[model samples]
Target: MKDSLELRTVTVTRYITPLREGGSLPALAEADDDFKYVLKFRGAGHGVKALIAELLGGLIARELGLKVPELVFAELDEAFGRTEADEEIQDLLQFSKGLNLALHFLSGALTFDPAAETVDDTLASKIVWLDAFITNVDRTFRNTNMLIWHKELWLIDHGAAFYFHHSFSNWEKSAETPFSFIKDHVLLPRASKLYEVDQEFKKILNRDKFVAIVDQIPTEWLEWEGSDFSANEIREVYLNFLLRRLESSTIFINEANKWRDASI
Candidate 1:
């Protein structure tokens, strides 16, 4: 078999162990000395939306040169048994199995203390920029829909990022009119723990490097009348939008630039 296929097969088997449960993709497998992974089955009803978002959002984030887990399409079979489900079962089988970053399921995979003072002001500012570009409103304290791995932020569960794609007017409100998040939250409280040691992330936030990163975004991920937007056009739209935000910011470009330098 081809290497990618083989890897996919291995990943499926790794997540087979029956362990814990809960969450959209429940925890079935845990940390083990051998063949460890997060057991995920496709028959649950709640995951269909999240799965689609994960796939598309992951692609976009990767194209923007952001850190995320390796995503692969997989099938659940003898190697990976089915899980019991409630009324949500039929919805789950609507799609096939997908293998994601299994290491995240490990109890010790990440040392996360959401309340801990890990995130810094500079890093928070950049994340806000990313969220704004994607229009991701779900990254609030309620969900804190992110995870850290090896001290690096690995974005996950983007089922909420592209809601506007489903309906362009869903967010008809312009970036102007006082947004709720801005009124309350203090982002960029600390540098992201991930940036503290990641050179790749540093390279990514550079003005020239950042624009190049935007260029890599897959056209398929953008939500348009058709998947017809050119990569350059998409990059331009994102850049212009962010530029407007910087122009509107209380700290102006200075804060954004601070992240570029402090991130490393």
Candidate 2:
């Protein structure tokens, strides 16, 4: 967390409705001072669970040397309602040249092309891999829930991952099975081609370091009304999952060292 960052309560000027036809509640909000930020809140039945998942998953991805966006704790009054009237929202939703009307979509703000692979794609693939390792099933094809900003892929909208309560028990079942980095796109031949980031990435991917990073997420963010799980409980699930995944990774790295005839 940065010391300069501030969280102030603001009234929602107007809610920008979801661009897509179906799914969860996503909104574009403008502050009284004219500062703009996208707000994704709980829908009619769903509470703040999506925000919690996004917050936690974003923290984990950043800790693992994956490129992601800068996330902050944003607060807004609960009463502000939503509408699809904003021109900026319409343009972005339609992927019209009208796209440039949005903030991150602005030139020089971020370097991501959803239709093409960019340099950041390699790292983005690794992030997707890490998400898979942790059973973050949200970043799938239909709703990639990721963005490219500052030449990096930023993870967002993770409420759909680990969504067993939402009739997605299969994803969890696979996570409980053996963890496999081989299947990870980052480990594939096309992605991580040079694997040039091995040293920098390895330094931060351990269980202890990851847990410490998770601690930095604001408690209020994690304690959403929609979530029945506690922060500690979430940490424990991820911690144990990482413990298993790392055990295998440790073996693989050691084997690589032995093959190179270096110290074990």
Candidate 3:
């Protein structure tokens, strides 16, 4: 069941502090919805593709029964940049004068210190499966892009996932691409039910489900110049890669299982 997750559009009311922790320089902004959001700018470091990944990854996690912050579309006006002091930041704000992606600000969310905190095998396995499915490279023991909010693990910062999009030319051939990085996944050792998670996801994920996820992305985000693919063609390409990856002998799942077994 596609939760029918649609990205809500909110306008930026006030520019809060800049979250320098992220490489993209996302900001904590007050949205018109009466909530603060961690805005990922379309015109940021990696362009709109990163924002697209964040939306897709987060929504997928939600569908997979994983804890993820609410994803929304944020509107930014040119006038908001006038109050900024730094030239670089001002330029970034100015460039991102249109709709951007935002994740609901999790207040008082404690940092997930894997060393101190613990996760059950099932929960850990699901997250590991999702990361592997999405080919996310950001989640590692060194940099866990997860937080403990309301006593539950919440995933974040998916901009680094879906690296194959950067090389769309080979995306089709890369369907069976193994995410060797899963061996270093922060929760690999704890994912005792890795195979179970893989099977469950395979049962739920289908072409319609995957296409629904891609359809949620704004058309403008899909549109790009200098690419052989038009907006509609790019959507089909994304759907095709996901569909093909789910075919017989998924390389990522096998690799993850190997890592889990070796850890045991």
lDDT of 1 by residue, 1-264 (tens): 443211233344433333333345444443333444443344442333344444445555665556655554444444233444432432442333443323235344453456863675546655655554445556655566567667776665555554433433313233322233422222433434323323333344445533543443334334334545555665565555434433344332234345435544
Window of ten residues with lowest summed lDDT in model 3: 245-254
Task: Give TM per candidate.
Answer: 0.50, 0.58, 0.95
Model 1 RMSD in angstroms? 8.2
Score candidate 2 by TM-score against the native: 0.58
| Predicted candidate 2 versus true structure: per-residue lDDT over 44-80, tens digit per residue | 1244445545555666666665554445444443333
Candidate 1 stretches greater than 4 Å from native: 1-11, 14-49, 63-65, 77-107, 168-264
Candidate 2 lDDT trough over 10 residues, lowest sum: 96-105
Compared to the true structure, candidate 1 yields what TM-score? 0.50
Query: Which sequence of candidate numbers ranks them by TM-score, best first?
Result: 3, 2, 1
Off by over 4 Å in 2: 1-13, 32-34, 44-46, 82-115, 118-125, 138-143, 146-155, 164-189, 192-200, 216-231, 248-264
Superior by TM-score: candidate 2 or candidate 3 = 3
- lDDT top scorer: 3
Report the number of clashing residue pairs per model. Answer: 13, 0, 0
